[model samples]
Target: MFAIFKIFFGLGWVSFGGPAAHIGYFRNTFVEKLGWLRDEEYAQIVALSQFLPGPGSSQVGFAVGYQRAGLGGGIMAFLGFTLPSVILMLLLAVLSSQLTESSYFQNVVHGLKLLAVLVVADAAWGMYRNFCKSPLTVTLCIGTAIALLLFQSVASQVLVLVIAAAVGVRYLAHGNVTKDKPASATRSFSWLPLASFFVLLLTLPLVGTYSSSVQLFSDFYQAGSLVFGGGHVVLPLLQNIVGDQLTQDAFLTGYAAAQAVPGPMFTFATYIGYELMPSAPLLGAIIATLGVFVPGFLLLVGVLKNWQQLAAIPAVSGALVGVNAAVVGLLLSALYQPVFTSAVITPLDLCWVLLGALLMKQFKLPIVWMVICFAAAGFMAPSVANLI
Candidate 1:
């Protein structure tokens, strides 16, 4: 447990970029470096998280930790993984007024955005090789990407996954997936966890009508529960939920801050909650964070024992393949818009991404070092801009 906590805590500090990058970091550390899980094992966790709503990357981390050290380890992993981003976001919320005016800081954020492009590109490539092996899977990847690029929203994203699953069941049903099953799932388990998951989903809305805090929890929780293709997909839902509470500038600032931090992108809630309830920032942060995260964990717990069994079922396996392929497409579409379009603003910016990608692929520079270099570049970009 200590080992799990320590590693995740370290990752929390440096796991910048976004969900795709975070997945890459986890794959590198746990699968390649530590041998905590095999490639296929890690892929299964990722695929499961991709299918579920909530913070997909964080759920993957939780699943990985659960596999390592029981339910306790899962909780510890969530804490260690989220602690840094939560703290950083809260601090940013408090100092948002000052930080927004700082040009150097803005440049640093710009650099990080560039880093996001490189990191996500690397992740997409790696995931493609690992998950999109068959021609049908590759076609699903492309088709999902085009569909999402055409209709970009939480609703469309979910639709794509559903369609993909249906296609998978129809097409890939007979294909084999090989992996050793975990020992824990072999034991008897209860239906209570699954029951509790739906109960909360149903009850939260009713309770929310009476209390503002409950409303906040419900809004974020609902966003977490329903937003597919996590990270970017959650943004519009949150924008609508807190539209009246925060000014557009303040909300945009928090969104920018979220991009700069590590851990789960869902920690954007920490900043919003702190801003909304300044008198009780800590409490607000905690409530919002847990509200957004708890549903995913609950769902994971409910499904834990059934995962292997479900995997063995031919129809389920086919749907999983479809879901996995669609995930790659979702990532591809995301790479173009908010990531690529937002990051690469000029020829120079494109050059920076190319350079960073080389350093990442050829030199295999540590993410921390890449962060430092890009931050320096960001700090200097303003000066370079003036000269240009």
Candidate 2:
């Protein structure tokens, strides 16, 4: 258990580049270097994460630890992997008020916001290429995006996902079925975690009315339960939940900071939680962080023992295909509304974004360097404007 915590704690500090990159990091560390699991076992964990909601790469890491050392190891893995980002986000929340007064600091925040734009665009486009290959799937992606852009509500998001799943089961089910393999011995899984997940999900909102902290937890928990694709897709849901409580700039700044950090982007909740409850910021951060992460881990624990058999079901596979495509669409909508609109106010901003894209795509520069370049550009923007 200590080893699991130590390994994941080390990873939390250096696992940059969001979910896809984290997957690579886990593959290298657990599969190649440590020999903790076979490549196929690692692949199955990754696949399971993709099909379920919450932080994708974090779930993969947790499942790996669970496979290694049981439930206690999973908890250790989650704590070790999430601790660094939680600390960083809390510090940023505490410091942001003092820093906002400085012109240079404001520019730096603006620059990081632009970085958010670049990061989300890359995620949306990459997922599009991977998930929207079929004509039917492409239509679903475009339709979902258009629907969300028009309606822009949590209900609309859920409705679209449901419809996509139904469509996938009807049409995309063809060719997805596989022949049955020889039955392996079934591993027993406790149902308590799964039951607890639903109990909290349903009961939290009712209890949340009496306490601010409970409300905060309820909001994050709902977002974690529903987010299908990965961390980027959490943006719109969170925005809908808390956008009114905080300024748009503050919200985007927290998101940009998450991009700059080196762990699960879901730690963006820590920043929001801290900002939301100024008097008891640490308590807020803890509650919000747990609320957002707990559901996914619970669901993973409940289903992991049976995952091989469950994943083999054709309808399940087909539905996931649709859900994945719809997720890309949801991200596309988020990219346009809050990410692109909030970041690119002038033609110069657009130019900066284009340049960042070039560096990311053509030169393949690291994310840390991109953060530095954008910060510098933001600092100099005022001088450049004067010259122009």
Candidate 3:
């Protein structure tokens, strides 16, 4: 457990890039370096995470720890991996009032927003390559992306995924059956976590009316529960939930900060929680963070041990393929909207993004170096414009 915590805690400090990058990092560390799990096991955990609604990479990390130690290990893994961003986000919330008006700070935020564009684009492309190999999957990916681009809402997101799953079952299930035996009997599996998941989902709203704090938790919990694609997809849901309470600028700033940080982007909740409750900021932060993370963890725990059995089913495996393709589309839509539209304002900005992509693809610079380069460019952008 301690080892799990230590490894993830270290990762929390250096895991730049988004969920896709984090997944790569986990593969390298746990699979390649540490030998904690085999390549196939890691892939299984990742597939399970994608199939479930949650923070994709973080769920993978949690399942890794769970595989190593158990539930306690999973908790430690989440805390270790999440702590740095939680601290950074809370601090950003505390400092944002002083920094928001500073021109230099605004420039840095802009840089990070652009960074978000590059990260999301990279993730979308990578997923597309991995999941959209077949004609049906390519069609699902394109269709889902077009649909979301047209109708941007949580309901639409859910609808596309459901439709994609049905399509996959109809068209893709025939030859996908696996012969692996079930890992454990159903009677031996624990259902407590699933029960708890439903109980909270049903009861949180009932209790939310009694306290603003509870309402905040409920809103974030819903966001975490419903976010299917990745952390990037959480933006619209959060914006709709808290937009009236916080200014668009504040919300966007927090998002950019999440991108700038080096851990799970879901820690954006920590910032939101602090902003929502100025009086007892820490309490709000803790509650909101826990709320957003709990449902995902619960669902993961409920399904982790039994995932092999489910994956062995031809229909389920087929559905996963469609789900994965749809996720790529969801991410592609996200890249264009809030990420690209919000960040790329000028032709110069587009050029910078292209250059960054080149550096990442051809030069193969580390993400930290990319962050430094983009930030420096942002800081100098105004001065360079003046000279021009």
Residue 238 lDDT in candidate 3: 87
Where is the poorest 10-residue window by lDDT in model 3? Answer: 176-185
Check candidate 3 and list the clashing pairs: none
Candidate-wise lDDT, in order: 0.82, 0.80, 0.81
Cand. 3 Cα-lDDT: 0.81
Model 1: per-residue lDDT, tens digit, 33-62?
789987656776777786677788898899
Per-residue accuracy of model 3 over 1-388 as CA lDDT, tens digit each: 8988998998887676677657766865787568998754665676577668889889999999998898999999999999999998888888885665678977876775676677778667766777889999999999999999999876787788889889978887765544553434354466999999889899999999999988989999988988876778888888988868999889988887887777888898999998889899999899889988888999999988777567557776677777778877877887787678878998778888999989977998866687788888888889877876
Backbone collisions counted per model: 0, 0, 0
Which ranges in model 2 have alpha carbons more than 4 Å from their true place?
A: 1-77, 92-96, 175-190, 198-288, 304-308
The top-ranked prediction according to lDDT is: 1
Candidate 1 error regions (>4 Å):
175-190, 204-219, 235-249, 385-388
**Residue pairs with backbone atoms closer than 3 Å in model 2 (clashes):** none
Using TM-score as the measure, which candidate wins?
A: 1
Candidate 2 local lDDT, 1-388, one digit each (tens): 9989998998887666567557656765786569998654665576568667899889999999899999999999999999998988888887774554578876866776676677767767756777788999999999999999999765787788889878878877755445652132144555888899999999999999999989999999999999876778899988998867889989988887787667899999998888888889899889889988988999999889777555456775677677778877876887887667877998888889999989978998866687788888888888877887
TM-score each candidate.
0.87, 0.67, 0.76
Report model 2's TM-score to 2 decimal places: 0.67
